[model samples]
Target: MRRLALPLAACLLLAGCAPTVSLTPAPQATAVGCASLIVGIRGIETIGDAQRRQTDAQGTAAWGTPASVTLYCGVETPEASALPCTTQSGVDWLLSESGDERIATTYGRAPGVQLITTRDASVNDALETLSGAVATSTRGTDRRCLADPGASATPSAIP
Candidate 1:
């Protein structure tokens, strides 16, 4: 009985240490550009100080113990919106806020990449960290976020 109890305790401890993150795959997970996007995502080393968490979804990734940041590739590209758009590392992202969560989706890239972060700082870090992957993996279009929508007749890409 003593031997069995020791082994059970060890098993429980090992189980608790398993690093797995629960994430829902994006609706367009199997979309045309997702294969390359997945490759790019897998190559990411780190986001801020957050360690990468293993995700069950094919085109999704999560980081940090409680998953402060998550990325889903293959989301539909967003159209022009009132949401604030920002460019980081040459990648344009459409930003939105809900409760405590901040969401950013790639604006001009097809099979868009969406990031959800719990903290504002994490969102910026995430965008900067993931920009290289996104730029390399996805196709870019002429569309861009305008600073003043009605002011410019020419659609200038945000620098």
Candidate 2:
């Protein structure tokens, strides 16, 4: 009974340390690339382990209470059609918004990335913190948001 008790306690301890993020794993085909993305993310700005959630997905991360920021490492590439693309911190992200949250992803890149952030959060800061990781972990392309010929402010791109 003593030996059984010790083993049971160990099992409980391990379970307690398990990841709490509840992400659905990406498809097996994309898992490998997703795994690569996770390997590069040693840390994210202002986010700690306690804030991270356990995800079932192969390559995904979440932060903040109730997860104000959620990121998926590998997703299907976006279509070539004209979508609102924005470039920041040397990264090109196709933007989409619903309610108070915004979703952005690397435009025209394989092993795609998706970042979700609440409106209250600083999108620029999030982009700055994540762009380097996304650029390092995935493939990139020449495609970008077309510059407005008449607009005075030209968009910036990371070389």
List TM-score per model, in order: 0.78, 0.70
The candidate that wins on lDDT is: 1
Off by over 4 Å in 2: 1-19, 27-31, 45-50, 148-159
**Model 1: worst 10 consecutive residues (lDDT sum):** 150-159
Which candidate has the highest TM-score of all? 1
Q: Residue by residue across 59-155, what tens digits does model 2's lDDT show?
A: 7887765677788876776567454667665667876667888777777666788887775455555677778877777777766656453431222
Model 1: clashing residue pairs? none
Candidate 1 residue runs with Cα over 4 Å from true position: 1-16, 148-159
User: How many angstroms is residue 66 displaced in model 1 relative to the true structure, after the best TM-score fit?
Assistant: 0.7
What is candidate 1's lDDT per residue for 1-159, written digit by digit as tens? 999999999988875774688778888888767778777677675788887778888788888778888899888876677767778777778877778788888889888889888862377678778888789878899899877644422211221
Error of 2 at 108 (Å): 1.8
Model 1: number of backbone collisions: 0
Residue pairs that clash (backbone atoms under 3 angstroms), model 2 = 20-54, 21-53, 21-54, 25-57
